[model samples]
Target: MASEAAAQMNFQTMEHPAPMPIDQRTQVLLTPGFGTQFTDHMVSIEWSDTRGWHNGVIGPRHPIQLDPAAAVLHYAQEIFEGLKAYRHPDGTAALFRPEANAKRFNDSARRMAMPELPEEMFLEAIRLLVEKDNGWIPEEEGSSLYLRPFMFASEAFLGVRPAKRYKFLVIASPAGNYFKSGAPAVSIWVSSDYTRAAPGGTGAAKCGGNYAASLVPQAEAIERGHDQVVFLDAAERKWIEELGGMNLFFVFDDGRVLTPALTGTILPGITRNSLITLLREEGLTVEEGRYSLEQWREDATTGKLVETFACGTAAVVTAVGRVSGHDGEFTIGTGGPGQLTQKMKDRLTGIQRGLVADSHGWVKKLG
Candidate 1:
């Protein structure tokens, strides 16, 4: 016999009702880092070609069961996204431009030969999860609940084609700040031997493969006393691409800001896009063009490169103190976070944490 709600929906809840105490939660909220600790509950939903998306559930945060021959395991069919859930001054929980992440998540899904999840469903999952764990949202300054929404192929198949089954999950972690010390002028190492992306590759998408390719070169840069590594174009190796995890920005001496144009290679970061808007609002001329390392070194040495920095979802806006290469190196504008970099970081984080007015409607309230 079919039940009355069978025509409507199916639901699931946690069998183990384990939640952290207020003291424990306070301890985590006070600590600061990304991907460090998880909340009490997480949201999970299933999808398959045969049945589409279904089986939504909110349960205790725990490890996922995967088959030995899962498609994601064998073929590496996986993608993920990162954003934050902020606790506002009025005692409300909110998210910053979650819909944008939904669109980007689908963008990654299409590029990775995976099924596209509906944008509403993606946002709904975030809303559901954050609402359930509202207590986990941190109230400290520069702190938030870092929301990580990920999807992967769950089919236990040996084939090379796209998997028929998929799993989408959202987990929240309380993160204080991405930069341990603070956002200051940092150093960048120019990588000549390795490039981040190639033509007609997974460069534009936020996939694990691109990050994996950057680790070795990034290690080289870190060993050489640098905080980050910047890549040149794959073909000519002249035009700037981006950093290992952030996007580059250059401030000309003439009061003009320039970032590398999106030429189907660089990742269109959310923070990058936001900065473009924030700078223009402050009555600054920002340009998107191909910036060369040779010119960067020359300009920085000659004081034409007044300011240099990076922007990303993780760190927001960070100042670039210097750019160093094998042959030569140059310090960017007195080797500290420039005036513009500091102001921009302040404005962006201000809007995110509700310290300033959100005229752009980028924040989505959760509770």
Candidate 2:
């Protein structure tokens, strides 16, 4: 385990405050609903044109000081990544596909006109923080230590150019499942009003601006009594895209699974990728291609679309109950988790928790 993890991410421990003992009750809150809280410690590193990346620190959680004129504020030069620390039954803690997060972080940085963090440094930051605050790891079912790593232009510049100074930091949240309210099916509002990205934009990169852009549309969906917003293609606004934060998947009654082709406008969620892999392993046929809104609605009405879901680090695999668009509303597959969706979720979670054999060797044990 160590060797495989080392090949992808190297670690350097940073000392921090002594961990506080977590009571059984508190631990119960940690897992049941995962990411609404945080751990006690955080990891950070600084970067500049002259000094480069240095002054690594893993310490008690605290607010960071930022200049009012920082480049991140003026130009919106920022990027972020998310993953989790899962507590195994053996009292050990591990991360699922952390190296993938590190790689995505670099991709975001490049797109945001910021400097990239080394793969080793990114991995080490999460490892040290999770280990230091090992007590904060929730022991509840589905609970995890949500690790957020982000970088932004920290230089106090006024011009509209990329700043050479930046800071990278990782904060951990003790997360419950994203839908603390319940695991009930969620409704999505189809948004043909706004475009998430253009062809040459930061659509695929896990950056802050994309999320910032999603806030307004998401608010509209909520106002309309929907749980989330789904976007269509930018140019045509006819093809199905993805949710504001998660990737979309469709299942057919005949057992064919399909997700949008990576057209550079959709975020390649780690969970989405994992599901494709796990399903294929179970002898399921998976398709990655464009599925238009008209085609989807027609299929659902004709009983072809059996299940629809959104995938992300926070939600894992959430069943999509209904899709409401400006034209009309289409309820999908009795608006519940389908047999295939549930089975895929179980298999993916099994691999994450060490409950099943990891054929792909995705788990990276931290201890």
lDDT of 1: 0.86
lDDT of each: 0.86, 0.84
lDDT of 1 by residue, 1-367 (tens): 1223233334477743668887977887788577778888888889889887789888888888988999988888889998988888889988888888989898889999998777877877788788888888888887888889999999998988999999999998888767665636778899999999988888888888889999998999989988889999999988899999899899988989999998878988898999999899999999999988888888988998899889988777899997888878889999998899899999999999889899999988776
Question: Residue by residue across 106-147, what tens digits does model 2's lDDT show?
Answer: 888887778877787788888888888777777777778888
Stretches of candidate 1 off by over 4 Å are: 1-11, 181-183
Flag clash pairs in model 2. Answer: 31-143, 33-176, 33-177, 34-175, 34-176, 34-177, 35-175, 35-176, 37-174
Alpha-carbon deviation at 128 in model 2, angstroms: 0.4
Q: Each prediction's Cα RMSD?
A: 3.3, 3.2
Clashes of each: 0, 9
In terms of lDDT, the best-performing candidate is 1
lDDT of 2: 0.84
Residue pairs with colliding backbones in model 1 are none
